[model samples]
Target: MRERVDKLKEEVCTLFTPSKDMLRRMYLVDEIVHLGIDHLFEKEIETALKDIHESEFASSNLYEVALRFRLLRERGFWVSPDVFQKFKGDDGNFLNELADDPRGLLSLYNAAHLFIHGELELEETISFARNHLESMIRDSVVKGPLADQVKRALRLPLPRTLKRVEMLHYMFEYDQDNGHNPVLLELAKMDFNLLQQVHLKELKEISSAILDDTYDVYAFSSIDECRTLNAAIQGWDDTAISLVPEYLRKFYEIMLSTFREFEDQMPSNKRYLVAFNKAEAAEWPHRNYKPSFSEQVALATETTGVRSLAAGVMLGMSDAATTREAFEWAVTSTDAIISCAKIGRFMNDISGYKVTVDVAIAKINELMEDEWKTTNRARIDNQAVIPVTQRLINLTMAIPLFYGYDSDGFTFGEQLREILENLYVKPMPI
Candidate 1:
């Protein structure tokens, strides 16, 4: 019997290792119904149970194995009532007891069964798993081989506790079908250090990729589109505006169309109604400009303004006058930077010595020096715009050599590249 059990264990391990494809296939509903029923007829339930017990199963893969066993029983494979009673009872209180058990492996397996079989609702399944996982994590029993198994079963990175928290947050925030406040509360208790590190690492990789691909496009097109539209509206050069790039022109047209659709869906007296009406007229000058263009531009401007103001407030720059000035400056500066990039001119045209490219560079340098001090400084939650503003400021400072302002003879692109290297590319000390 011992020799047979060892052989069976080896087979099961071999079947499951390196990948789960074979296990998933064998445990699927149709396969279980067919083979499990035949196995019951050929080998008694006691023999099967003995096989499982002697396997010395790894806890992580136990969930998958237990699920297979449950399917077998459900498919009319006979098992004594006593075996069923060991895990569940007539009252359904067995799950709660199992959840509280010091040995969480079995509980996790049972929870997986309830989850996969839809015996419990999605929220209930997630909650049960989270609670049990948290208990195991807090008990600190989830280490060594057990931890490896848990990580494998959960299909997440190690330090299972933090993964649980992030999963809970994702479920609560985005999984409309499984949102549960209690699970969120439980998640909040986890160590945020691990979570933040993981999140920031992911964001850094994504941001780097985006910057690499979109920096030139975003910088150039945003200016060209806005300037063409602005110039057309101001009646500066109708023929030049007509020469706008087809793709960008189409984007403006689509923006106008979508804005109109959105406005049409709104109720009367909504604040957006006023902007929508104005935007409709703004689109007329472009070949494809429609009445809705004004509405879309208005909407975009308002959204940008609100975000900028919120960012200012979050940064503790909430003085109403200062915040308003900063937001206005951000909008104008953003437009100007884009315009210059499109015209292929740098800071040569920008006025005001105090706020010039040189001053911006000095500010970035000062901020870099005091980056440590700003570690605990006020932060804006609207991360997208804050960094964009920082980049805009930096780019503004780096490009457009002032006429007598050093005349170092470095081309605009070269200067901008140097600035990006210094401000963004260099790795910060960890």
Candidate 2:
């Protein structure tokens, strides 16, 4: 599998005119990312994007300018919104003629959303592009991949939708078009479904464990406030903003309640994770004034949602003592816990931190392997525990996202329950 992946990646990198053809390379970067296979060619993708940013678009076409700005800013690179200046008229709005071009309008619409705190031009561009694109959808005589892409992106903007989910969506569109690369499309389909089943399997276990243990109802009241919590983090205001400090305080209270559960199962000294709670408690809001990538992930992991789930894992498993020790391993900021928390931060991006789940799970598997060698447990029980815990860490961060974001695949709470039962409990009729 690794060899096949490497060969495919080499072929993919060769397909790009990385240095000279800025537009084509950028488009390839976007497609590769959307296909959910960019991790296989991270350096190549990063280099291409960086070169495009430095060369900075050979064309002044709206799609070129918009795509360049959107891609760069979305990835956390420093790019100026002033680059959109040339696209505007003397009257200080996006060129009136550009509105007639559906593709350009769509590109601008996407670029507008990447604006952080305050950028008046990008803010205005969003309104202008949205109106034009909506009209394109309503009018007659124009319909194809270009128009369809606009419609889907309008319906579910880039920032809000998950990358993997979006890629799955794009695959359907790609399948219909003769323009898409056939070999790459076949490879992408294989990679996507393989990962999809892995995610579904983990999600099934997560939903089942949530049901068996009865943790769903407890988090319901906090859902609304947590949603507001996410909103405020984005610089948006809500009445629930008042609940921010209180909600943060109450988070530790929940952690303490879960920690108390470890008393019966864990050693007396290990039962109190005062330092863990204290370390997390100090960073109430994960993103501070000028937050870095590393800083944000560190703070996110400390959220009551992630930490509480670590506590719940101890209670959920059959071997209480071993689970408690594993929980302790997680709470102490082990590689497993930190990596898992980092991924949780991007739960919204769908493409964000998702790659990390496989990384974090791999680390936990390593830890489990080390323990397997040291302990004298029965082979059957030890094997069972590793897979279960691997899935647990994979989905732990995801569970917190239900309140703030929607899942394209699972859709609703009842749908989640049904999926778990169908995928794991009942067999498909052959």
* Best by the TM-score measure: 2
Give the local distance difference test score of model 1.
Answer: 0.35
Q: Give the TM-score of candidate 1.
A: 0.24
Per-model TM-score on C-alpha atoms: 0.24, 0.55
In the predicted model 1, the residue pairs found to clash are: 279-294, 279-295, 280-291, 280-292, 280-295, 346-400, 347-400
CA lDDT of every candidate: 0.35, 0.55
Give the CA lDDT, 0 to 100, for residue 299 in model 1: 40
- Tens-place lDDT digits, model 2, residues 1-430: 4456556666786876546878888788777777667756666766787787778465788888888877776554567788888988787877778867887788888877666544667667777888888887888424876777777777655644456445655776777777787656766765655555676777756422111111122234444544444333333224334545563534433433444555454444543243333333333343343556556445455543444455555554446345544555544544444445444444433422244466764664344333222221111123324423443443432433342233523344574466445434443221
Give the Cα-based TM-score of candidate 2 against the true structure.
Answer: 0.55
Kindly report which residue stretches of model 1 are placed more than 4 angstroms away from their true locations once superposed.
Answer: 1-66, 69-86, 95-122, 148-430
lDDT (10s digit) by residue, model 1, range 1-430: 3344344434433433333343443332222122112221222332343344334333334345445444333222322223323454566434555554433444344333322221333224435565676667667756654444454345421111122223322322332334323322222222222334555566676421111112123433354554444444333233444645665555444434443543332333442432333333333444464446335433433422232222223243324324444454443424433322321121222222224466765653343223211210111212223333433332322332322133432333564355334333432221
Candidate 2 ranges beyond 4 A from true positions = 1-6, 16-18, 140-142, 200-430
